[model samples]
Target: MKNLKQLELLEDVLENSSIILPITINGKRRSEIEVAKDTSKNEIIALAKEATSKWLEEKSIIKEIYVPNKLVNLVVK
Candidate 1:
């Protein structure tokens, strides 16, 4: 995913995958929803998309969905 310097774009991907990505902002994950990319962005985004697609396609598999607490949404306020 291209860094927007703000990560809101990841919201959809995270929602669809039902998984939180762990990001290192200021050295710690704001919650636990940060995506890890060790190589080219193209490769990383593709990987994330692939994983999410697989999770969606596997209808029988149950994935855990974690909703961030209210406090986590307070940073902008």
Candidate 2:
């Protein structure tokens, strides 16, 4: 198990190992998504968007995908 902020090679990330990544809206923590350690950055972003869509305002936009910190930030009107 890897702690948050610990950097590791993708090859060493196993499917069975997962983490709860933080999802933020306008720099505020909003939701969380459990994803495999091997999940790609794009996939993590998609999951964050889906998980937070309900509370997302109209015309909301994803602003950042910071994998190192396991955080997905969104911009909302």
Candidate with top TM-score is 2
Error (Å) of candidate 1 at residue 51 is 0.4
Candidate 1 lDDT over 1-77, as tens digits, reads 45773477676555555333442222333333334322344444344334444333534322232223211111110
| Overall lDDT per candidate, in order of appearance | 0.35, 0.75
Can you write out model 2's per-residue Cα lDDT over 1-77, one digit (the tens) per residue? 57543545553554357888889888889999887777888888888889988877466574655655367887777
Residue pairs in candidate 1 whose N, alpha carbon or C atoms collide under 3 angstroms: 21-33, 21-34, 22-34, 23-34
Give the range of the ten consecutive residues with the poorest summed lDDT in model 1.
68-77
Candidate 2 global TM-score: 0.68
TM per candidate comes to: 0.24, 0.68
After superposition, candidate 2 runs with Cα above 4 Å error:
1-16
**Alpha-carbon shift of residue 69 in model 1 (angstroms):** 23
Candidate 1 root-mean-square deviation in Å: 15.9
Q: Give candidate 1 regions above 4 Å deviation.
A: 1-38, 54-77
Q: What is the TM-score (0 to 1) of candidate 1?
A: 0.24
Clashes of each: 4, 0
